[model samples]
Target: MAEAYPWQEALWQQLAGRTQHAHAYLLHGPQGIGKRALAERLMALLLCQRPKGLEACGECKSCLLLAAGSHPDNYVLEPEDTDKPIKVDQVRDLVSFIVQTAQLGGRKVVLIEPVEAMNINAANALLKSLEEPSGDTVLLLVSHQPSRLLPTIKSRCLQQACPLPGFEQSLAWLGKALPDSDEQERLELLTLAAGSPLAAVSLQAQGVREQRALVVDGVKKLLKQQSSPSQLAEAWSAVPLLLLFDWFCDWSNLVLRYQLTQDEEGLGLADMRKVVQYLAQKSSQGKVLEIQDWILVQRQKVLAKANLNRVLLLESLLVSWAMLTAQR
Candidate 1:
């Protein structure tokens, strides 16, 4: 039984009150905002034989089956591999499931997470199912990038935006989730997660704090010319490529911010304030923007699943940063 976050309470209440739900719902929001949790909770609520308020009755057969991951009418579709495309065949199977009668004789639910991962063919295949879902069915499409979906698909479902919680809300949640973390550490983690509390929790669980420090230290060394790009890239090879690029992109933006404003107010890299200040003083705005643009290009390449040599990519990025240290 998935529980809703504090920020999701209002939405949960609203959804609970609705006796008649749309055939499909598109829960679109930024990544790490708990959309999937909300969707799963809703699925449980819909599937519960004896529902109580917005929650599922634990003793119900449906609830037990769902908990055991054998719910006959509840379907979840995702990419077969991480960061890969969901193919058309998966949607074809979902179509077959949709046509079948509900085993529990209650509402059927289908959940597709990060639906943007579906390629053009898969997206097209899903359009027909999304348009005309059979029986008492609810299709929940959870997307971090809804803009990538076809326009016709968007028009077929009710759009729900799950927004990031405010800083104070996030801080309170983090304090409870990570009680061992001090105030400063909580703030840093929350900032790194871009105000997403769940993402902050995940970062802590993955030991991102230690990895981040190493990456930051490596960047400092690179800027000081103490290490070469190839060496730093090899040292940080164990780190996830996307996460490393995201941090680098953030740092690049901070450098640009400092160059433009000559102040470090609200910078994401608060722990590296001195480094940001130093780079701001030494690097020209033009140079910083060039690096920022390059980072954006690299990020797009990664998102597009371009065939890239990981070491070479990181090496080139580091070399670019090192060169910027010499900018007048």
Candidate 2:
């Protein structure tokens, strides 16, 4: 059985209560908010031989097959490699599967996660299946960044926005998900995860807090002239490039926010609050904005899986960041 999150209870009721299901649904939201799980739950409900009031009957044959990963009526499309674009050939294969009759004589369901992973050609290939529905087939498209999707693709489906759970709700859930961690640690994790509870758990598992501590220490050293850009970049190589960029990007934003609004509360996580405030006071807004722009552009390239020289990239970023306080 799919884990039904408390935050998604109302969403589940609304979706499962529909008298007639849409041929396709576009579930769009921020990452780590359980959008994929919600889609899977819906898929199970649609395929279940006997549904028990907005939920799937776990004892049914269909449920058993799905749980066993042998369901013929369901298909999942995703990139072969993580962070890579879905190839056109994969979409072609999915098109072939969509045309086939369900072996169980029930509804055929297709789930494509992070749909924005499809390149233009692959997305175009998928459009054919979306334009012409076959039998009782239902397509569920999940996108963390729906803005990247084509307008035509967005137009063909019932677009549903999945919102983040409230802070109190997220903390309550996190208490159960991470029983060993205290409230302060969980609070830090949730803040690090940008208020996404699942992301908070994942960050905990990935030791993101440790990685963050290392980076924060490095940043403080860099500002104090105790470390070189090259040294810190190589030392932090094991940390994910995207994660590093995200932190720098966030820090830059916080610095600018504090400089403009002078809001001490806006200085982000406690790990770097002092640094953010110091940089904000030392650096000019123009210089901070410039660095922020550069970070955003490079961040996009990283997100696109560009062939970047990681060490060089990090060194350059640190060089610019170090200069932020040089003018003081």
Backbone clashes in model 1, listed as residue pairs:
none
- Candidate number of the best lDDT: 2
lDDT string, candidate 1, 155-239, tens digits: 9999999878899999998899899999988887888888888888888888888999999898888877788899999999888
- RMSD (CA, Å), each prediction: 1.8, 1.0
lDDT of each: 0.87, 0.93
The candidate maximizing TM-score is 2
TM-score of each: 0.94, 0.98
Model 2 misplaced regions, further than 4 Å: none
Provide backbone clash counts, one per model. Answer: 0, 0
**Candidate 2: residue 327 Cα off by (Å):** 2.3
| Model 2 per-residue lDDT tens digits across residues 184-204 | 999999998889999999999
Q: What is the alpha-carbon lDDT of model 2 when measured against the actual structure?
A: 0.93
